[model samples]
Structure formats: C-alpha cells, structure tokens
Target: MKISIYREKLKDKINNKKAKIAVIGLGYVGLPLAVEFAKKGFFVFGIDIDKKKIKALSRGNSYIQDIKRTALSELLSNKLISFSCDYRNIVKSDIIIICVPTPLRKTREPDISYVVEATRKIKDNVKKGQLVILESTTYPGTTEEILLVLFSERGLKVGQDFFLAFSPERVDPGNRVFNTSNITKVVGGVSKNCAYLSKLIYSKIIPQVILVSSSKVAEMTKLLENTFRAVNIALINEIALMCDKLKINIWEVIEAAKTKPFGFMPFYPGPGLGGHCLPVDPLYLSWKSRRHGFEPRLIELASQINSHMPNHVVNKVVELINSKAKHSILEANILIVGVTYKRDICDIRESPSIDIIRMLLEKQANVSYYDPYVSQLPIGKKSLHSIKLTKKNIFGFDCVVIVTDHAKIDYSFILKNSKLIFDTRNVFKKFNNSKVFRL
Candidate 1:
C-alpha cells in the first residue's frame, strides 16, 4: 500500500473514533496527557511498567494532584481510557506518545534509557503508517539519533511506513495558567510528512500547535527555554548574595526592576533552583555540547552558582545558630519548613532541599522538616522522616529554615511558635524583627 493511502486510512479511523492511542510511561507528564486524550474522545491506553501505578489508575485513583479522580472515574466508566502493563496492546495502537522520564545521571549526563526502552518495546509492534510522537524533554537529535535508529532496525522506513516526531512536554505541575491541553505545543518531525501528520494529531487536543522545521529544532527549543531561566536565575542569585552583604533587600530590587516592564523580564531569587526542569535540563544540553568540542560556559557557571545556594543557606544557618547564645547544632533543634522543590505541589524530583539536609547531617546537626504538602520525604543518607507541623512541633526546634514557600502554611502560627527563622523564599510580606532573616 502507498504511504498516503495508509495515512488516509489512519485518519478515517481517528475521525470514526476507532483509533487506539497508547501513552507509554504514565508518570507526572504521561498520566495527565493520557487523561487529556481520553477526555477528547479517543480510545486511550495508558501503559507503564510500574504495576502499582497501573493498578491505581485502574481503580480511578489519581496520584497527581492536578488530575481529578472524578475525571478518571468518568473515563473508566465510559471505557474510553484504561491502564496496562502489557506491550501486546501496542499492535492495536494507531498512535503512540512516549512520555517517559529523561533524568540526569549521577555524572550529570542525559540518561535516555527509558526513551530507548520505550522505542524498543514499540519497534516490533509498530504498524504501517502509525504515528509515533515523543513528548519527553530531551536534547536535540534525540528523536532522530535515539528513536529513529530503533525503528529503522525493525525494518520500517520513517515518514513512509511510519512517522516520528518530537513534541516536548511543557507541563508545569502546579501552574494554574497552563496545562496539557491549553499550553502551546511545539512539534518537529524527521521529515515534512512527519511534521504535517504530527501537527494534525496534536491540533486535536492542544489549543495552539507550532510546527518547527526539524526534530532537532523542537528539541533545542525546550533546552533553550530552560537554559534561559537557569542562567538568569543564577545571575539574580549572585545579586542576592551581594545585596545581603550590603543590607539591601534583593526582593525590593527585583520589584523595582520589574516596574519598567519593557526591556527587563523578572526572574526571582529563591533558596535554589529546584524541581525537574531548571535544575537538571540545562545540564543535558551542556553535556551533549561537550562531545562536539563545545563548552557552554554560561550554563556551567549557572549550574555552579545555583548548586552552591543550598550550601550558602546552610552556612547562614550555622552562623545564626552560633551567634544566638541559645544552643548549638548539637543541642539545638533545626526544622526545615518545606521539602518540595517549589511550593504548592508535592514533587521533589531534583529538589535542593535534599542537599541542605545532607549537608546539615554531615555536620552532626539534628535536622527535621515539615511540609504539609509533602508528608514523607525520601531521606537520602539519613533515616529521618518529615516532622509534624504543630504549635508544640514548632517549640522543639530552636530555629526553622523555610526552603519552600507553600501558600497554605500559616505564617502567623509559625512566627509566634518558632524561636527564630531563616526565610529563603521571603514568604513574609513584611519584615517583623531580628528573629527572622529573609534570604
């Protein structure tokens, strides 16, 4: 059969609501995306090697806060979406989107194992004219270099018998403004046909769809967006350290800078860059660049500055504890207010709070934390669990450090109950006294 005839047949299936869409790796990015597709009236199958995750979705229970249980229940009741751990269903899927995790290795390298594994699983079952899209955040050349080779080995010609495209997932976990469906999606394909077909598929769900020239360009777009934030935030972090020495509030400086609203764009200073993207994604580009004999100096410098922030905060804690005549770290109880990377949502993928706690433990400091949003934090080197957040819980800690600024936390209660505090997020609207210091 001609490729165009196959494409037309697939289109007819989709129009008739007969196309089976498979979403691989049902995690933070994948689960929400699967739900969106299911809601859009597609027969969606959410596949994950994690049996527990599959079982939870089968029961219509959502692990992600953004995904409503009722939505899952509706999809399940309608028999529009279901979860599975089997790869045999791949043969029945008309379209497959890879939404696996692209994490950094211990050496700060891009680990594309999950992406590769997903491609390998689908390679054998890939039907003629099936549209395969990758929604994982990865470096340029990933769609071509990583995904294409796997399919080619299976004797399918891309853009002919099958299609391949990269559409980077821009899912912000807690952001109210953007979600899977409304966010502008950027897609690039290995060839012209691939681009057109990919855009057609996504245009059904996303409000706006942008088609880039090639897969590499689309991949590069995601990297540049994150690298821009990483560099700018590093610059502000440096300025914040200087302002602290000069007794100037960096938050006020940022507020004044934001007033122009013309040439300047505001990126605030924080305890440190955390979460999945800003902290880890930039390094993937930098790591890939090294193979081409290129050094991303700005990215490297930014990583250094951002990574050093937790240590700086820890030093401040040591200084404050010593200066106060109350108790030393050995006798003093230290409470870390938030454990998640950013506020509101409970995702600690690359959270800097882990680094802070580890450093404190190395110094023999008794450390405990309270994140109402995150009840249990995975202790890296220590066995300690999340501390309770109560008035009496606050009394035990000699000093508290605010790593994340959750909107739900009662600041008035903390201020009255805690002895002292080091506020990394400037959660307080107004400076009250010496007991509290804003980073």
Candidate 2:
C-alpha cells in the first residue's frame, strides 16, 4: 500500500512537469542528459565536483561537443536548468541520475571509486518518495552490491520510501547519428516499482525504454555491448596483419565482404582501439569473471592483440624508412597527421597516436604532428604543437603517416607534394601512386 502511494506521487509529478530532476557528474553523458530533460519541459539541476564545468554551464555555455551552446543558453534563459557544485541540491530533486565515469586504474583493474563516492554523496541528501538511477557502466552486480548497501545503511525502505535502478549509458562521442533523444534506453531495477518509475522518467525524454529483470542484467548488458566490439576489432586487426604478409589489401577484402550483407559487419583496423569504451570496458568484465574462478580466454586474447597494434605500426614505419628513404630512423624527419583517438573529435583519452609518437621519438626520429582539431599535445616530459600543413612543411619530411583521417584535411595537397606516405587508415584509396602505401 505504501509503495503504491509513493509510485503514484512520483508518476504524477513527472506527468505534470513538476518533477525536479538532478543529474550528478555533468560530463559527456550527464550534460546531454540534463539538457534533454530541460528541453522536455522539466526543471533540472546539473551537479558536478568540477567548478570549472559548473562555472561554464552557469554562463550558458556547453563544454561537450555533442551539446550545442544555443540550446544551453535557451535553457538558462527559460530558467529550466541550473548548474551547481554542491550536493545539497539533491535533497530537493524528486529524481536523481548518476552519470559519473568508471575508468580503469593504472593496473587495468576496474576503478569504481567514482561511482562509490557519488553514491555516498547521494545517500547523504536522499529523501523519501525519490527515485535514483545509475547510468555509469560497470561489471555485473555493481548496482546491487555497492549502491544498494549504501542506501540500505541510510535506513530507507526501498520500493516504498525510495526507488533504485540501473540504466547503463550508451554515449558515443563524436557520433552524429545517435543522440540522447533517439537512442533506446535499457533500465533494470531491484523491484517492479523501481523499474516502472525509472522507465517513466526516461520515457519522458527518450524514444524507447526497455525494462529488464534485475540491475545485474543491465550492468552486464553494457559490458557485453563493448566486449563484442573489442573482440571483433581484434579479429579484423589480426586479419589486416596477415593480409600484409600475403600481399593483399585488407581494405579491398573488407569492401568485397561487405557486399554479402548478411553474416558480416565491417570493423575497420586502425593503429589500435581508443576511446573510453572499447579499450576499457572489456577488462572490467574479465576481471570480474576471474573472481568467480572462470577464465575469459577470448577477452584476454583480444586485449593482447589490440594492445600490441601501436608497436606494429612503429615496425611498419621502420620498414618503410629502411626500404624507401636514404636515412635511417635515427636521422628521419617523420610527420604524423592527426593525433586524436578517432576522427573529428578533440578528446585524446587512451589515443594510440600518442604511443606511436612516443615510440618514434625514442628511436631518435625528429617527429612532428598536425591535427586541425587539436592544436597541441602535452604528453609526458615533452610538449609538441601542431605544425602548419603547407607544401613547404610537406616537402621537408621523410614520410607522412595518416594516423587519423579528419575530413577537414586537404589530402590532395599532401599527396601532390609529399615524397612518401604511409596510410594506416586507408585514406588514399582513390589514388594509385608508387609513393603511397597502405596498412
């Protein structure tokens, strides 16, 4: 009877546009989510520990690439959203969403300290008749084991006095196709009331809301999604290496295989896997699996292959310099184009281009890079700036390697003036020239 009354009250607040929504950890995921809710006519509070982010948002500015500045300014003008670095705002919010990052430690173990700490802050200000949902990705059983314990310690009767759920975030940075409004959101909770209430809140802003049986299922769903990508990427990368020895272009083979359209999904080969999801999410699952005495052999093997790709690229550079250029690697003037992890983004987290640049510098090569999105690289112990992409700059290098293929670059200008080119991303597929090489 008590659970029904609380559920009705929450549902009424959401339907009438009176619910005060709070989103914690305003980052790539949280900022867009908070904006989406505000766009849907709900009052929102954007909370984070970073004062710089809060200050910027308070001025009607957006730091995330996916969110537009005009939309943020409009929300601020309408008084639908506000930013804060305080946790006391959570007490007044009827629904709270956690969107903190779950990164790996230096030892490659799952570092869930951010999630745990966020839960502690939430517990301190939680009130009855409120709903809490976690959107950070982690191993299975994290919501049930870690978050539930914290709420329980507060003496709140969940499903009656409070509601808890897990809804993993599927944020793809720099992806223009899918955003927060259209993507399908999968939600799981500790009880039916929890799942229903959480689904109602998300349904107001998202296109689809899927309800699962338990929070553990939602957590595992996120891991499986990324692990599948990591494993397939490793498979295709190994195939690319083999294609090099067989004197066949892997890109050509992939283009032909993609014609069948049934049993094949094209996963491209690059220097290696980068970004927050592909390189880090798989290890979280494998680490958890090992605790139960189960060996995830496939996951480990994929990680090994992906991790060694930077070295493979370095070896290719050495071979190219030895066979074509007059100077050794120690005396070469190598230029790398594009340093970000992927194309058309400014984020540099776990980028393979950094490792490739470090390796080239270790061999005494005079290396310089040019990226239109990134103006400078502040790597460890050394800082390099992006050089201009003129004919004079192109002609001065021993070879130019295309590490990332941003659309804004003038590739024809480089090809017309460069002496030799090593293309890791197959950016020179249209031109047939003796000076161009593909990986």
lDDT of 1 at 410: 90
Candidate 2, 80-147: lDDT as tens digits: 99999999999999999999989999999999999999999999999889999999989998988998
Across 1-439, the per-residue lDDT of candidate 1 in tens digits comes to: 2347667777777777678899999988999999998998998999999999899999999999899999999999999998999988899899999998888988889988999888999997887879899988898899999889889888888877888999999898888878999999999988877887788878888879999999999999999999999999999999999998999999999989999959999987887888778988998899889988999899999999999899899988888888873567665678998889998898987788888988887788888998887777777644667776789999888789999988898988898888889999988758577799888
| Top candidate, metric TM-score | 2
Instruction: Name the lDDT of candidate 1.
Output: 0.88
Clashing pairs in 2: none
Instruction: Please report, in order, the local distance difference test score of every candidate based on alpha carbons.
Output: 0.88, 0.92
Instruction: Show model 2 residue runs off by greater than 4 Å.
Output: 1-3
Question: What shift in Å separates residue 282 of candidate 2 from its native position after superposition?
Answer: 0.5
Worst 10 residues of 2 by lDDT: 1-10
